[model samples]
Target: MSRFAGRFSGRRAVITGGASGLGKAVAARMVAEGGQVVLWDLDQALLDKAVEEVGALRGVALDVSDPVQVAAAAATAQAALGGVDILVASAGITGATVPVTEFPLDNWKRVIDINLNGVFYCCRELAPLMLAGGYGRIVNVASVAGKEGNPNASAYSASKAGVIGFTKSLGKELAGTGVMVNALTPAAFETPIFLQMPQSQIDYMKSKIPMGRFGQVEENAAMICFMASEECSFTTAATFDTSGGRTTF
Candidate 1:
């Protein structure tokens, strides 16, 4: 699939968290398919390395949770890239694993700020660019945990749940505006985000997947590409599952 060409030819994309993990995988796929991608992440060094690795991919150090930063980045990105046609809201973090009753307030807020709020900030700022362009594709990377809440992962679960809701609402609002908004709910994939979780928690998550293993980054990226492509017409305010048989709906 990496050898395939021009799936996203002549398109421009803004991908949050594209420095690594699932986000990087998607960026690679898009660029390989002939799309121009501008990646936004918090780590400048990693973003630089990723851009070099992906070849022709642009990098920006952005904190998506900040609306001011998001707006500024959007303006700069639009100016440089001409305009954004697709947005992959993949920047997120999984806070510490703990029971809701024991969850620290700060951790909960942090998770929400990044995972849920970040998605909102990106869409709120960038969707207008797409809307004005008269075309757009938004694929918000949510989680299966949002559907079937993971025990002891209250903050992560809640943030993702909020994303699902936000995607639906936003999708509807943009239904007739030549833009489609959707969410991808993937079950535990072997991404760097795993480093933030306990091994015990990881094992428990694996146990819930009928596939009996973590998902592959490529698999999720494939779905995202389809969702971000013109072939994804007529699907908005919907949740596409990439959960390895964990979610049939």
Candidate 2:
């Protein structure tokens, strides 16, 4: 993984939810490319360890759903990195799994707050940094559920759908600003995040994938890195698919 093609050399990146799973994988890759990275996650202990593990410049304990935390972290990043060239809004969670009518209101709000609003807050606070530099790449991690709603996961589905829409609007807003915004709609990947789901739900999602299995974290990191790289030039506000044919739209 340390081949170092220098694809992200001298780049500074902040990846929310960089403690583990897909986010963690991306952080490792970016660092291997000679980029400076800061891992942002809600758990202090996890963040501390991930920064060391991924060789990231540092780790910031951030709850992106909290605008104050986001703003403070944005300032921290601005001061530390001086200028950020990449942002991967990958922090999120899977709330309780249940029928919409049976869904807990508290659970719904929590999911939306973290999955949808968190992405918005990070972009809101950090996009200005990118705009100021006149060069940036943002890859918002969404899900195939956003495109094809998953029953019993209403909040998760709706929140991710919001991410896709947000990415589109922001992409266009920064069209000529040298900052590109895009999103990924990926199929279920077998990560610790997947362990949060019920066995039945996991099985259901895997069945939908034409590949007849869940995706790997490395498979996801590959797409995410491409989206975060300078090579992503010419594409903005678009939804890239990694759903193994479960979604082609």
Candidate 3:
């Protein structure tokens, strides 16, 4: 289904984490549907590569956790694209795995800052623009861990849980407005993020999934594009799970 087939022909989008993984997949899909895209990420090399792959799209090196940097990036994106019709906040990190009692404070904070706070920073700066325009869509990438905490991943779970709450609250606040806010709770996806974790941890995660396999970046991207499209008019403040039945509730 081409939900955004011709819908984004003249529209513009801002995608964080667009350098790779799920973000890159979503940005590619958006561009395929004829939208002008601005990709934001912290890795300059990856961003350069993504720009090359996604021809005609702009790329910016942005640290989402830094409010000043996020704000500046948003401004630059708006200036370049004229204005953002869709904002996909996909920049995130998988924190080190360990029991809560043993979890390092620095690691916890880093995870929270990147996964949750970064999303907030983007929203805080971009929401107003959408509200003013009286039309916008925000799709934040969350995780199934947010709904059901993983055994040895307190920081990642908590941060993603925060994303759920944040999305819900913001969605309600903008219910009457034209802007729609939503989050995607995806299970383990075979992305570069997973490469950061140990093989044992990866194996454990895959075992827990009912599908007995990791999710694909394209699968997650499909859902994100739907939520970011104009057709997603009624669904907001909700978590759309793509967890391969890992989260049936």
Candidate 4:
């Protein structure tokens, strides 16, 4: 596992939502390969636990949905980490599963604010630092539901779709720069985020994946690590699919 020790040596990374799920997996992978990682999450206890387990990782707790907080945290990260070489915008939420017409207005806004706007806020604040450093990798965690809309999860789907679009636009804007922006579209995964979804919705998602199983966090971390590595130079403004054949398009 430490075979790729030099792959991320001397690199500093920021992983939002790094306290758990796919984000935690990616953070662990980065650290295992010799990178310095700073985890950002809204849960103080989880952040503390992740830092304890990851060892040497710096954890910052803040709501990514707040632009002001994100900006301030990014500044602190620059000072603490010296400069950010990689950013994995992994923070998100799965709002209520009710139909669009019945979807509570508050729920819709909450999902959009966290899932979509939070990503924008992170990129908005951190991209400049990357631009100054002249070397950066940005991987945005989107979902298969974003491409193939899932019934009863309109807000989650829409927010992720916006993430994909935003990645494409930002990738192009930073084309000639050292920054590479891309998104990962994963199929259903058995993460705690499922707690937010209805049972029927979860079963429906599982049935759609041709593999007949949900994705593993490690599987996603592998793909993410590659995308965030120096080896991923030629690709940008694109979406990487980890959907187990659910999205061949």
CA RMSD per model (angstroms): 1.1, 0.9, 1.5, 0.9
Residue pairs in clash, model 4: none
lDDT of 3 by residue, 1-249 (tens): 355567678778999999988888888888888888999999898999998897537899978999999989989988998888889999998888888889999999899999999999999999988888899999998999999988888899999999999999999999989999999999898998987788888888898899889898889988898899888999989999999999976
Global lDDT of each candidate: 0.93, 0.92, 0.89, 0.92
Candidate 4 per-residue lDDT, tens place, 90-200, comes to 999999988888999998999999999999999999999889989899999999989989988999999999999999999999998989999999998878899887899
> What does candidate 1 score on TM?
0.98
Candidate 2, residues 1-249: lDDT per residue as tens digits? 556479999899999999998999999999998889988999989988999898998889978889999999988888888788999999989888899889999999999999999999999988988998889999999999999999999999999999999999999999999999999899999888877899999989988999898888998998999999989999999999999889968
Could you tell me how far off, in angstroms, the CA of residue 210 lies in candidate 4 after the best superposition?
Answer: 0.8
As for lDDT, the candidate ahead, 3 or 4, is 4
Report the Cα lDDT for residue 133, model 2: 86
Error of 2 at 231 (Å): 0.4
Lowest-scoring 10 consecutive residues by lDDT in candidate 3? 1-10
Q: Which stretches of model 1 miss by more than 4 angstroms?
A: 1-4
- Give the per-residue lDDT digits (tens) of candidate 1, residues 1-249: 566588799999999999999889999999999999999999999999999998645789988888999999998889879999999999999997988788999999999999999999999989999999999999999999999899999999999999999999999999999899999999999999888989999999999999898999999999999999999999999999989899856
